[model samples]
Target: MPKQMNFIVSKNSFEEFGMMVILGTTGAAMETQMNFFFTFWGIFQLKKGYKPGVAGMPFPFKKLGGAMFRKMLKGFGYDDMWEMVKDGVEEGKIKLYPCSMTMDLMRVKKKQLREICEEPVGAAAFLEMCDNADAVISL
Candidate 1:
């Protein structure tokens, strides 16, 4: 059996702070030998039409407000979180799989997701992969 690493996320947007951290951390971990699994809101980061906004933030920053915050964050030189995931994928260490159940519930189309998703897979398949994983994390 292949060694495995599993992560399950159910947060919507970037609000699920824990999942966001996992996204970035797991992306870095991609350099190692592992497969990452994304479920529910965890898949939001990969949504092609999704856009980040501060509307739901405590301060409710809108439009340019969110843009300015992003600019400030990017001054650190790293692209936004999703871009880092892309880099990991390019290195052949990352495999992005959106949960089939989540996709059906949320009505997210395959074309709506970024190029990272191998395919929308069922929970049973995800668990099959997770069973082989050396570790599993659910956020």
Candidate 2:
């Protein structure tokens, strides 16, 4: 596990958020260090009190999908996304890095982010982090 595991997230819709958690936690169980670099729409996932929903789904089916998604999570023996995020960070398996460039471009303040997030990182810093990564995935 010498490879630095990093996930470059670009969205935070229901599916996107779920996938990121699945991948991040998988790395968590592996005991390999992991990073989640949230950018663009993904940045909101780290914003304080933000609740991800099935926004990408059509209006009518969104409510159904969201209910099903929550049920699926419970079936998998997990609570909420934020709980997993907090656990992962506390366990030192995952670090949340919200893109500073995105934050600036979007006029987001550091205080607007979740307390679990590390200091905002710029593009160059993010690239430097990924320079040692085994794989850099975008979603």
Candidate 3:
């Protein structure tokens, strides 16, 4: 059997989400099963119409640099991070799950999430899913 991979997303930043999409898609393309678990602020990324911008930089430069970086990516013919993630889902290369606890704490409804979110699961459930995974990555 092929390897199963699990990713935990805890940050609500563009860089983190972007890396998740990249790895998720690439892993699936490589014939691995990939699952993404979104928690905490990361749940925001699963929200409908959420746009990820560059994060993790010091103030002032983060916003400006993010916009410039996105523009550069566009010029290079790369789809925006959200589009990439959606495409990954559409291609059956990614499975998305929002953390149930985070959803409850944030008062987020299922309808508020993008169609890509398969379901909401608790931390224990998430761990169970990862128990047999060949690799588990946290972002």
Candidate 4:
């Protein structure tokens, strides 16, 4: 079985976050501990009522792209992203942490984030948590 794995999520794109979730949950199924840290643009999608959009699409095309992306994911039998995260948390194998500094700098409040995320933590605290992780992947 794998040991602790840490993920530094720095983007809020479908490709990055979606793939991370897949790998993280696969590891979790093997009883690996998964720690995900959301920072910068990554933290925004963790908020409630957030709709995911394809990264780097023209403003007018983003909505359409997101729709197409969701359809593709659904074809692959994947549930909504938030639902998957909630499942991982409820299964007790994954923990999500939002960067406190990111939130502060972006003027985002803790209450705005989903409850599945743990209490926000600074980069130092997150680094400490990663000290023993077998792998640290940045996405």
Listed per model in order, the count of residue pairs whose N, CA or C atoms clash below 3 Å is 1, 0, 0, 0
For all predictions, the C-alpha RMSD in Å is 3.6, 1.9, 1.8, 1.7
Q: After best superposition, candidate 4 residue 120: deviation in angstroms?
A: 0.2
Cα RMSD, model 2: 1.9
lDDT of 3 by residue, 35-61 (tens): 999998999988887766678777767
What is the lDDT of every predicted structure here?
Answer: 0.64, 0.83, 0.83, 0.83
TM-score of 3: 0.88
lDDT of 2 by residue, 49-113 (tens): 77677977887887578678889889989878778767878998889999988998778899999
User: What's the true lDDT of residue 74 in model 4?
Assistant: 91
Over 4 Å off, model 3? none
In candidate 2, stretches whose alpha carbon ends up further than 4 angstroms from where it belongs are: 60-64
What CA RMSD would candidate 4 show? 1.7
- Model 1 reaches what TM-score against the true structure? 0.72
Q: What is the lDDT of residue 22 in candidate 4?
A: 90
- How many pairs of residues in model 4 come into backbone collision? 0
Worst 10 residues of 2 by lDDT: 1-10
Better of 2 and 4 by TM-score: 4
**Off by more than 4 A, model 1:** 1-3, 15-30, 53-56, 62-69
Q: For residues 45-84, could you state the per-residue lDDT of candidate 4 as single tens digits? A: 6888876677778887776887788889899998876777
What's the true lDDT of residue 78 in model 1?
45
